[model samples]
Target: MISPTLIQAKGLRKGYGQRTVVDGLNLDIREGEVLAIIGPNGAGKSTTLDLLLGLRRPDAGTITYWTTDPSPHVGLQLQSTPFFAGFTAIENLRMFAAFYGKRLKDAQLMEHLHRCGLEEFAKTDALRLSGGQQKRLAIAMTLVHSPKLLFLDEPTAALDPRARRDIRELIRSLADKGTSIVFTSHDMEEVHKLASRLVLIRDGRIIASGSPEELLSQYGTASLEQLYIQLTDEPA
Candidate 1:
């Protein structure tokens, strides 16, 4: 069964010094759904994410969350790793949980580490881990509080094929376990593989949105890449 709407955004708008980044956008983030927001470099995808994550305030809009306070129920993983200097992997997870006002047992922390494949590196400095390991650790930190909603920005942007596949599988696992995920990605294949629904934006506005297969059939395109280009490319 489809879950209820976890987040509702209406008439979202944001601007910077006479230039608008997010222009009158609206979105619904449903429970247990994997929603992918995709667009070109300057399409304001990141800005929209920031607005929804409450990292940045929208110039005009209303975002309603299921809970009174959404922070405790939401998790976020940015593209860059934000590990504390000199902190081990497990320590960082503990720190993050503490930030959320929750103290987890050692076994619980270890379970998170094991889930992210970082148990072996529990004592290792997070910064000393490889790029992929750091990303995995970042994800583990996000899950420390066991949030109901997750926002991931380019989770697998710069990783090896194996690491990318690992992260993809992890996302699939999370969605299968009834975690609502909202993520942004430039990789069309990854978006196609993981996104239950796709929101294609241009210049801060949604040009198209629907299930990947639905969009493909609507546009009569072979793949998400072709549809993306057709809708986002500049007119000659």
Candidate 2:
């Protein structure tokens, strides 16, 4: 059976004065799937994410959500998550829970912490946690309200191999339980492991998009990295 479309964006165009970041883009985010947007530094991946999450309004386009109240159903985890330095991991979760009007019991909060593999550091100060732990805490904060749609920008960026694997597993678990995710990452391996579908953007336009196998076959490339290079590499 075909999954329902959770979000539909048509002709999404955004720019800063003369430079267009996202240009005439069209995309559909389906229910209960991981869609990864991959691109180089200035490819407007972040801008596209911001626009989709309603953080920035598109200059020209229509974004439609299937749900009547989409705002409450969405969650966002940015590249640099902001946390109170003095707050413990649990405290941070509690504070964000309050922001979402959620009142989580200590046990419930601990369950989330354990799920993120941060149970041991539940009482640790947010600033003291390792990079991986901090990222997990950020994810816990985002999932506190149990949002149906998650927007993650670089969820596994700058982490060691084990940390990246853990985060990837956590994401896969969430998807297994029916959470729809749209994320951006430069790690082609991470993208290969997590993304059910992939979209490649360059200089504000979607250059290529498809499932990993589909794209590889279409481009006749050995891997996503080679395909990406082939698609985005400038001629000498």
Candidate 3:
């Protein structure tokens, strides 16, 4: 049996005064799947994400959520997660939980911090945490409400190898437990590892999309990096 569609977007278009960011894009996000949107800088990946998450309104398009209570069912983790610099990690989680209209006990909150590998940093101020720890804390904040669908932007960016692996594992674990994810990343290898479906966008348009293996096979390229360069690199 096929999974039900969670989000369906049609003709998604966003633009600034003179430049278009996302143009006539249509996509479907299904339940319990990882969809990775890959692109170079200025390719509208961020804009697409904002539109999907309702952080930004599209100039033209319609987004439909087939599931009830879609608003609370979604969560977002951006490249630079905003937090109170003076607040401890645990305190930040508590604040966000309350914002989401949920009250999490200490034990429950600690469980989430542990999952993100931030248990030891629970008492650490958000400003003092290392880059990876901050990222993990941001991820932990997103889970305060137990969202069914997650939107992550550059989730593993600027992390060391070990930290990157940890974040990747955390994402996999979430997917294993039936959380649908849509993420944008410049890391081709990371995308290949975590994404079941890939969408390539360029200059505000989707140019190619498929599974990693399918894309490699179709482009006759050995890796996603090569295929990405071939697709997006302009000839001099």
Candidate 4:
């Protein structure tokens, strides 16, 4: 096994200036588990992700991965960014894959392209691909190394329905293989569909964290979306 849990963050805190984004947060993402973070606008979801990914230093607290070998372990699919816009999709993967110090053959790269349903676009320049395609390419890069701990930010934000389904399936398959995931999304349905555990963030704090069913029953709400508004907006 890849261990019981892959990531544990305690009292995690991060912020800019006076605005504390992620405040005294605590999280435990286990191996082979899909944990999703759902929250309303400006809830510091991205900030929390940044802290976990080591993209930024926490204002207070610590994040440690549970593993025998700890070598700055984590992969992040940025919330929104054009990856290798000037290069072809395959070419971009070729470039990013090198950083992992693992050699994924050309055939393997093609498989990821195919998985993204972008096999036809393999030769297409990333800049030429549509917004959704670009996002898929970024996600493909993150998986190239098969990193055990992954932090995905709004991965399917602009994807069409079919693309969304494919990405969700891909994530599930990875988790099945013992990969841990921390996904952030504004799409309530997507979070519920893929997240084994859900953590709701509001204004830089985790307002609630539990299983999807637990959240529904706890709030007596019909759906996660409804619960989201109730928790964050407090229902005027």
TM-score for every candidate vs. truth? 0.94, 0.95, 0.95, 0.92
TM-score (C-alpha) between model 2 and the true structure: 0.95
Over 4 Å off, model 1: 234-236
Tens-digit lDDT string for candidate 2 (81-122): 999879899999999999989999999999999888899999
Candidate 2 runs further than 4 Å off: 234-236
lDDT of 1 by residue, 75-173 (tens): 899888689989999999999899999899989999998887778999999899998889888999899887899999999988789778878998899
- Between candidates 2 and 4, the one scoring higher on TM-score is 2
- Report the poorest 10 consecutive residues by lDDT, candidate 3: 66-75
Cand. 4 TM to true fold: 0.92
Candidate 3 lDDT, tens digit per residue, 91-204? 999999999899999999999999888888899999899888899888889889989999998888888888789889999999999999999889899999999999999988
Error of 3 at 144 (Å): 1.7
Error of 2 at 109 (Å): 1.0
Compose the digit string of candidate 4's lDDT tens values, residues 83-188.
Answer: 7667899999888888778677889999989987888999998888999998998898888877878889998898999999999999988888878888888889
